[model samples]
Structure formats: C-alpha cells, structure tokens
Target: MSITAATGVPVIEPASVPVLELKGIGKQFGAIRALHGVDLTVRAGEVIGLMGDNGAGKSTLVRIIAGNFPPSQGTIRFDGREVHFHRPVDSRAVGIEVVYQDLALANNLTAAANVFLGRELKRSFGPIRLLDHRAMETRALELFQELRSETRPHDLVKDMSGGQRQAVAIARTRLSNAKLVMMDEPTAAISVRQVEQVLGLIHRLKEQGIAVMLISHRMPDIFAVCDRVVVMRRGEKRADKPIAESSPEEVTALITGAKEAA
Candidate 1:
C-alpha cells in the first residue's frame, strides 16, 4: 500500500512483510539473561513506542536490533528476508538507522560535514579524489528544509542548541534512506521547547513513510506520537496495545509487572 501526501508525493508504505521483526529473541551476558523470548514488529509509517524501566531489557533489545550485539537465540527478519546483522554497517545496509541517547554528533564538525561524515561524496580523481563539500552542504540543507527544520548546514555542532542538534542527527538518518529509524530517549536532556521540536521531527519521519521504533520512558512523549505502545518487564513483553485503548496508569502498572490481565 502507498499513501499520497498533501504535496502529492507518493509515499510507499512498508512492504507487506514488516520492516523489522524479532521472534522469540533472547540475549544473554555470562550468567545473566538480558532479554528472553521478546518479540517485536515494526511496520512502515507507524511509530511503536517501547517502554520499560531501567534494566527492563530495552537497551539489550535495541542493541540486538541495531546489530551492536548478536542474539543468543531467535529469528530476525527484515523486509521478508531473514537477516543476521553481525555489525552496525550490516544493519545500515538494510535501511535500519539507530540514534542513541548521546546523539553522536562531532562537536567540531559543521552540520553538513557531520551529516555526511563517513559517507562523504567525493569528486572522481582516481585515488586522490577530494571531498565534495559543496554537494554535501547543498544536500544537507535540502534535507533539513524537507523536514521543515530551521537549522543551517553551516552551523557548528558545538554552537547549536539541543533541539537543533537533534534535528541534525535526524537529518543524517534520512540521508541514508533509512526505512526504519530507531530513537533511544531522543528527548531526554532537552528543554520543553526542544522536546516539542523533536516530537515534530518524529511526525515528519512518519509522514515520509518511515517506520519508527521509539524507546522512551516519558509517558507523555510516548502517548503524544505513538500509535501503539509495547510494555516490557523482566525482559519480557507484558502487553502491546493501542495508545488510546490504554491509560498511562495501566501501562505503567504493566511495565512494573504490578497488574495482570483482568
């Protein structure tokens, strides 16, 4: 299926096969089991918020999905094909982009340079080719404008505000043609206004038909943008329900394993 935007751009819906699927996933560290029998599905154009307290296996699960760690047992499928992401680059190859809590921007690099950090466009000059700074800056500006962000390509990362920095990180993800964008506590240290800006960017990602997996503990943030919420407790999925069908209190209880199905 496909959706047409108000601007008449045809946004292709995620394939019938989920963009990302984890079935009976399990991960262990030494004698400790970080995650066990956890299953997740992320579809195109939908935002799924993952909620759990610290040590609830949110980090382990994300690491497994992002290819930072391999699962001990389970099957992961992307776009209908079984995939084993042995490294971060492997994950990126399949259009899976992860934005960690740190936002990973180079403090000294300009916004455009950071956006194309490792994937720089270069003019062909055999082995002596130089970086195409002009092209990168132009493209970065276009992407920011497309997302309706106000940040400029020439801005220094260290000089920008929190929200602007977040926008730049998100723009970098878009540059990779990411089909699934996973955000880990994207609004953690920002001001209220910055939080709003980041949330708006999440919506824009959905508008572009990208599948988003959001990891956050903030109930208001989750409820504001997520179509569905998945609660995890003791490294297991406790419940998956539509945001509107569940109350914050009920979800919190589920996360803490304080309530069972009535």
Candidate 2:
C-alpha cells in the first residue's frame, strides 16, 4: 500500500485487484435471451477455461467481453473500475485483446509483417516516411523468443504451421501489453506436438502476469492449462470452480444438462 498525497490514507496497489469481473451479466437478442445472470471474475496471471456446447451463450458472452456488443444488463469492471465499451477499439484501449479461432493472419505476409500489420513501424529521413522492416523484424524476433517459439520473423505465414501462426497472433497481443487475452479454440486442428507448443505459450503468458480466458471444447487442452473451469449451458452458467475440484465427466454432464448448476 501507498499513502495518498492529500488524505494520507493507504492505497492498495492494482496487483491486488481482479483483472476482469462481471456481475449479473445478461444479454438478449430481440425475442431471444442469449445469456442470463452470468457472473465471472478473472485475476492477474490466472487462466480460465470456458467450455460449452453450441448455443450455450459462450460466443455471446465472449462477444460482450470483446466489445463486439454490450450486455443487455450487467456491470463490467476491469481493474476495479466499471467500464462501458461501445466498440471493440474501446476494449482494446483498456488492455483487452481477443484472438479468434481463425487466427486472423495475412497468409501472404511474412511473420514480422503480419505482426506489425496495422501498426507498422515507420522511419522518416525528410518529409517521407518508410516502413521500418528491420525494426519490425527485430521486435518480432524478440516476441517469438519471449514466447519460446521457433517461428522466424521473415518466414511467410502461409508456409508456417498452425502453431507458428498462433505465435504470430499472440506476438501481436504482446506488442499491445494486453492485460486480458481471450483465445478461441487455439488448438483446434493442430498436431499433438503443436498443441503442446501452444500450451507452453499460454504458460509463458501466465508467467508474465497476463490473465487468459481460453474458450475451447477440447477437454484435454482445458485441463492442461486452466487454473479453473467455467461451463455454460443454455445461455446460463452451470459451473464455475477450480480445475482440481471438477472432473471431465461432471463438466460433460453439466454441458448436456444431465446435472443442474454446481
């Protein structure tokens, strides 16, 4: 704690606060309700696995958090301050980043080019500015090294494997110093070794005090990296607990509605 300048009162550091918090979150689309009474909390350096079947409101909830849309009713607090996001940029401005299932990379571009796609570095010698390829490649190399990935900065993304592509996307997030990262099915169609690579990257993010929310249907992936599991069914949250206290069988039952909320 630190003393406040004016009142001389102690102030708690932000490290003690939760990174993301949702209270009574709900969403509706016309006559249909996509989510209802969902509450969640994520702390720094924690990984949460969000699992559910189709139409379980998983996508809807993610969209809301990503600022694709706003919740019909709820309070979203980030770093202990309530915020309302009207657009995706708003969320990104607050250190929230999302990596969709597609991995959204320009296959025609090199790893370094892709990493600096929209926010490319530039240098000026007079009135003209040129793209700083060397600087970008150097920074991209550093990011790949930080993640312990073997991806080469100058390699074409189209020639890279699924795991390497993931590294490029994740490297972009690192460039933003993102506080929360929401990953959608990162290991969907990768080889066993590649899956391990991705999981290792997740571990690296946690080690750096970044909060991760992994949305995946693969049981093993979730069990492998998540500190806690949250299951959604029929637009409502069915279970939220530590990974050790829950089993795959129980989660399956929850998703299928064979068992009620736990």
Candidate 3:
C-alpha cells in the first residue's frame, strides 16, 4: 500500500511495477556458487534494504545488477523490458548507479570537481574549449543543498569527512540523472550526527522518486528508511517482506538463518 514519505511525497507501493526485476538469478565462480536461484524486484520511489551476513552472495547479486558481470542464470528486466547487462557502462546507460563504501573520490580533487569528475561541463569558443569550473561549482552547490549537506563544494575531498565523501559519491548520481541508486554500507563508519544527515539524504532521494537499493548492515537504517527488506543467507534468498510487516528481531533472525524463508 502507498504511504506518504518523510518529505510528503507518495511512496511507491510494494506491488507496483518494478523498475528492476531479477528472476531465477544465479552466479558461479567455477566450483564456487556465489548465488543460487534468487529473485528480487525494486519499484520506483521505493527503498529496499538488501540485508545479509558475510558470504551470503549479496555482493554477487548487486554486481550482477550493476552490470559488473553477467549472471550465470536468470533474466533481468528493467522498466518492464528484458535486458542483458554485460558491462558497467551498460548499467550506467540505463540510470543504475552504485556508490560503494570506498566513496571512490580523488583525494586531491575539490568536491565540485569530484562531483563532475569525468562528466564536467565545457564551454567552447571556436574550438577553444575549457572546463566550466564555475558552472560545476554552482551545480554542485545546488545539489549539496538539496541533500542538506553542509560541506563546501570547493573543499578538497581529502579534507571531507566520511559523510561528506558519501554525499559526494551520491551527488554523482544526480549528475548522471540516476533512476536507481544502490549504496553499499553507507553508514559503516561515521559520526552519529553524520549518519542522521545521510539518512535524511536517502529520504530526500525517495521524495524525488528515485528507487534506492540500500545494502547496509545497520538495522536502524533499514528500519528508518526502507520500504521493504530482502535478506540473503548462504547464497540464497531467505526473506523478502515489507518493512511494516517485519520486526527488527525478525529480520535479524532471517539474516542469521534462524528463520527458513519468508
């Protein structure tokens, strides 16, 4: 059922048509099976928490969706159309952006520069083109403001804190006009205040109608923002339920393999 988001926007219902769907997805690394017969679906404006213990194949599943590699078996549907994603660019071309825990920002680059790293704006005059630093800075400032980030756009990434680094990585999605944003361990190491800000940003993203797949170990984060929770254990999906229908202890049990399936 639909509900109002934190920002007063309509939240997508769990039964809505999915923005991305994985059917019988599987992955194998020679003799090692990384994933086995997994099924998942994410709808627009929905935040899904992909939860699991270590070695549960969460990374393999996300990598497949991010187009880091081809799935060994199964089909992927994007916006209701079947698609094969063979490369990272293939995923990016379709508005799927992943922000890993590394943040992946250039240490010496300014936040604005990092935001527009490879996708910088250019101004040309008779074949004489130059990077539009001012435009990028302005755009970055606006994006940061939207996320309620206090970090300055001109500050070097090396000087930014964990939350700011995460913010910068997320801002890149805005530059790419992302439709589905997947974050891995967004609040793994950060101050409590910073975590609050980052969580707020996730809510803002939902208000903007962007689908989010949050892979965080923080149960509070999942409870705080996720509309649905999908749990994986031993390379298999154990649970997939609406957040409203499950308790924190129940999800924990599912993750720890105390519960068989959802």
TM-score of each candidate structure, all chains considered together: 0.92, 0.94, 0.92
lDDT of 2 by residue, 81-200 (tens): 999999999999999999999988999999999999899999998999999999999999999999999999999999998889999999999989999999999999999999999999
Clashes of each: 0, 0, 0
| RMSD per model, one decimal | 5.4, 3.5, 5.5
Worst 10 residues of 2 by lDDT: 10-19
Best by lDDT: 2
Instruction: Name the top TM-score candidate.
Output: 2
Off by over 4 Å in 1: 1-15, 125-127
Q: Residue 93 deviation, candidate 1, in Å?
A: 0.6
What residue pairs are clashing in model 2?
none
For residues 152-251, write the lDDT of model 3, one tens digit per residue.
8899999888888988999989988898999999999899988988888899899989999999899999999999999999899999999999999999
Which segments of candidate 2 are over 4 A away from where they belong? 1-15
lDDT of 1 by residue, 1-262 (tens): 5556667777867547788889999988999998999888888999999998899898889888899979999999998899998999999999999988898899999999989988999998877999999999999999899778989999999998888888899999988799999999999978999999899999999999999999998999999999999988888888888898988999888877788531
Clashes of 1: 0
Relative to the true structure, candidate 2 reaches a TM of 0.94
